[model samples]
Target: MTSLPPALLRPLLCTVVLSTPLLANAQEQRPGVQAGITFGATTGAYAHYDDKPLVLPALSWQGKRFFASPGSLGMNLYKADGLRLSAVATPYTLRFKTDDVNDPQLRRLHSRQMSAMVGINADYSADWGAVAASVKREVSGHGGGVESSLHYSYPIQAGRFTWVPRVGVVHSSARLLDYYYGISDEEALRSGLAAYKPGSATSPSLQIAVSTPLGTKWRATGVVANQWFGDAVEDSPMARRSSQTSAFISLMRAF
Candidate 1:
């Protein structure tokens, strides 16, 4: 072999010694971030806030099956055997404005109260499907209330693409529904509009999601969801206000 320079050999030895530990450290700390966009029918422009079809950005972190996002910024623990525990937070509103159903001269009323929520969710999952139930207590806002929901998700895969269909029902107590969607007498007069009453509401919703792997570490996803209401509740006044259905498409990536 040609004579090797001692200077080159010394650096080679150092690199070999250092790289092994660095590689081990990297493997131990499997930290990663995933960012993407999402569109939902009822959630509006801010996929998390609007009650209408909207396109919004999404980001998440997943470490050894523990996943989190800004929309679900709380901690979650899960097991493969169909058990999950989660804590999440989201923004909510109470009063909003709307056009009357043929009544003239009355402008929209506004309460304009904003708030946040902290709640827990429990779910059971399996290869065939998943059922999730949650009870969330309002942490802050004009009036406190409770929210409960039950949902199911089923998955189908073809080649590199996966399709998931979900269905769910939600029920909110009077305090919860009114607190987020009901306007008060004072707010009505102030906004130069008619005041409305508060009551309970229920929604039954369905959604479909199609996702395909973009590469070894990325994926693209699309979704469309629709929600129909029960007589107990009024739809969100701030959004497209639909007892009718809506749809949207989106793209997403994960690592």
Candidate 2:
């Protein structure tokens, strides 16, 4: 399959993941437009990538059975009380900037690029937390990989703040790993690096999120997550580290 250029890939992913609302999750209270700014950072996975910070807009909309948020979207196809099934879209919006990597060979590598996936998600929600499972495949980048994950989260209330802790495991196919990290024969010849292929990989991740009300019409939120990539991704010649970390904090005003 012909893959899209990085320039074309991003907007396509955003449109699919952030522009549409989900069909279900009736309890979601996305009243009015919420807008904010987020400041965050991620540790690079490939060689030579230094930790970099990102500042971007945060926006979301929620209603009856649908919700659209930056980088994530869902439409509940079916909902019965707290147990719901929905069609979901998620863009793995993360990418690497290779300009400053330590390895000249790896620097010759192409941009890690970006992709979006679509699939179905199932969730069971309660006062405690939620159990969720999903499967999606890369649609925009044509990474030719599919992912499946199972996740669980619990929310703990503390005064004016609510904290949620989540843990999940994601499994990706070999094709996906190769597309993102593998060095092709041509790339090896041009970059003077041995060709390497990392097969399918599974990663386990943990995340924590906190939200607090800011007086009347504003809210503050923060989240950080870490994932340990599987050996298939870690062992790649382009990898500088096996683990990746990301952080975000934002304040939003409801319209």
What TM-score, over all chains together, does every model reach? 0.68, 0.83
Error of 1 at 63 (Å): 3.0
How many steric clashes between backbone atoms does each model show? 8, 8
Candidate 2 lDDT tens digits, 103-184? 7777777766667788998989898789988888888865768889888888788999888788989898988778788888
Model 1, clash count?
8
lDDT of 1 by residue, 67-117 (tens): 555344556665456686877675542223232212232244433344566
Which parts of model 1 have CA positions greater than 4 angstroms off?
Answer: 1-31, 38-56, 64-66, 77-80, 93-108, 187-194, 235-246
C-alpha lDDT of candidate 1 relative to the true structure: 0.53
Pick by lDDT: which candidate is best?
2
**Winning model by TM-score:** 2
Candidate 1 weakest lDDT stretch, 10 residues: 20-29
TM-score of 1: 0.68
> Clashes in model 2: which pairs?
22-74, 22-75, 23-75, 23-76, 24-75, 24-76, 48-101, 48-102
